[model samples]
Target: MSDASFSLNGTHPTVNWLGQVRAPGTPGSLPLIRQTVVEAAETCGFCDEDVAKIEMAVGEACTNIIEHSYSTQPLNLDIEVKVGRYDNRLEVTILDYSSINFAVDQMAAVPLDDYIATGRRRGLGLFIIQSFVDKVEHRFVCGQGNELKLTKFFA
Candidate 1:
C-alpha cells in the first residue's frame, strides 16, 4: 500500500478536489483503490447503492489493467487513480503506465443471457464497468500511457 495525496480545489468554497492514489499494479492494491473511490463518492453525497456500484466498477477496471494490461511486463509499475467531485457528478481517472496498446474498440459486448447460462466466470469486467458507471472514456497514447475516465452523475 502507498500513501494517498488529497487536495481541495474549486472556484467556489463548497466544492472539493477529492484526492489521488497510486498503487502497485497488482490485485493486492484493489482494496485500497476501491476504498478510496467509495470514500470519495460518499463524501460527494452519493447513496449507498451508488457507492457500491462505483466501487465494483473501479475494482473491475483496475483488475483488468492488472490482469490484461500489465500481464506481459513485471509488476513494478504503478496504477495512478484520481477522484474528483464536480457540480453534478463524480469523476474517477485511472492511468496505467503499460506500454501495451489495449484495443478498447475491439471489446465486443457480452451476451448476458448466454454468459450466465453457461456459468461463465470471466470476461465481464468491461460489461460491469459500463453498466455501473454513467459514462466511460478511455484513450491510449504512444508514450503517455492508458487513461480510463469514469463519471457518475448525481441523481
Candidate 2:
C-alpha cells in the first residue's frame, strides 16, 4: 500500500483496500498475484465462488501481461493491483507497464462453443474472465501503461 490513490472517475477516492505488487512479468509470478487478489476479495466479504472467480480473472490478466506484454523478461516493471469495495459492487484493477501494442478493449472473447469446436488447448483466458466478472474494462495510456479493470456486484 504505497502512497498511490484510487479514484473512480479521477475525482473522488473509490478504493477501500489499495495494494501494489512488483513482480517479474513471468508465469512464475502469477500465483503471488492471484493470492493477493483472493485475499483482498475475501476481506471484502466475497463468497467462496465469487472469490474463486476473481482469482481466475485476475490470473488471466496477469498471464497476459507475463506471456505477451512483458515477453517473460525480468520482472522489473511495476505491476499494480487495486481492490475497491463499492456499496453494491467490488472493483479490481490490474495495471502493468509494457510497450507491446495491443487493443484489449477492442477485442471480443471467442465464443465458447466456437473455441471448443476449434479444439484449441489454450486461448480462453479472456473469455473465461469475461464470463465470470460482471464487467471488464481495458485502457492503455500512451506513456502510462495498461489497465484491466474488473467489476463484480454482490448478490
Candidate 3:
C-alpha cells in the first residue's frame, strides 16, 4: 500500500501521505516515501533547481520523522505532503503526527560554550528546510500533531 494518494480538493490537487515505521528501522518504506514525495514535488512543475532543494529537504524531513517520532516499537506516523502551483510558486507542506525530541534549540544557537566546543551539527534539518524554501511555518496541535510547511517561489 502507498502512503500517499492524489486527490482533487476543490480546484487544487492534493496528496495525502500516511504511514508508520518503527524507530529501529524504516524497513523498505523509505524508498516509497522518497518516491511519492518526489513525484508530488515534480507535479508542482519544479525545474532542476527546485528538484535539488526538494531532494535535500525531503530527505531531511523523512529522516527526522524516522529517527525522532515513534519509538522503536511500531508507531503510527501520518504524513501529509501537499504540493501546489500558484502565482508562479511551488508550495509544499509536510504534516506529521510527531514531536521533536532532541535538544534543538541548544544545538542550533550554540549558546553554551560546550555546544560551541563540541561543534556538533545542529539545526541541520531546520536550517536546510528554511534555506531551501522561500518560507516555512510550523504549528503544534495539542492532541492531533504538528505541521511543517515550506514554500518556494519560482520564475
Candidate 4:
C-alpha cells in the first residue's frame, strides 16, 4: 500500500488524496482490493450505501481483469488498484499488466429483463459495475496495461 498527492492534466482537478494496493491477479486478492477500496471510500466521507456500491463496482472490475484479462496467461500477474479522492468524487482505477487488450467498447450490454427472466446467474459483471458507479473509463497502451477507472460522486 502507498499514498501520494498529484495533479493530473489541466482539465482535471488535482487529486486530494491517493492510495494504492497491488496484489496477485487471483480470486484470493479480490477481498483485499475490495477492503482497501471500502476503507478509502469511507475515509473520503462516502455514506454506507455508497461505500457498498463502490466496493461492488471495484470488485467486479478486478474480477473481470483476473478472469478475462489474465485468463490466457499461466503466471499470476499483479493487479494494481489506485484509489483517489477528488473534490467531487472517489475514483478507483484497476490496472492489469496482462498483454491481453480487451475491447471495452465491444462489450455487449446484457438484456437485464431477459437475463433475469431466464434465471441466468452469470455475465452481469459489467452491468453491475456500470449501474453502481457514476462514471467508467477504460484505457490501454501497448506496453503499459489496461486501466479501468470507476468513479462515484459524493452526494
Score every model by TM-score. 0.86, 0.84, 0.61, 0.89
Give the alpha carbon lDDT tens digit for every residue of 17-39 in model 3. 43322222253455665565567
Backbone clashes, candidate 3: 0
What value does the lDDT take at residue 38 in candidate 2?
Answer: 86
Poorest 10 consecutive residues of model 2 by lDDT?
12-21
Model 1: lDDT equals 0.84
Off by over 4 Å in 4: 1-4, 8-12
Best by lDDT: 4
Model 2 regions more than 4 Å off:
2-14, 72-76
Extract clashing residue pairs from model 2.
Answer: 24-75
- Comparing 1 with 3 on lDDT, the higher-scoring candidate is 1
Global Cα RMSD, each model:
4.1, 3.1, 6.2, 2.1
lDDT of 4 by residue, 85-128 (tens): 88888989888998888655347658789789889888888788
lDDT per model, in order? 0.84, 0.79, 0.58, 0.84
Ranking by lDDT: 4, 1, 2, 3
TM-score: the better of candidates 2 and 4: 4
Task: Summarize candidate 1's per-residue lDDT along 5-31 as a digit string, tens digits.
Answer: 334473442335686899899999998
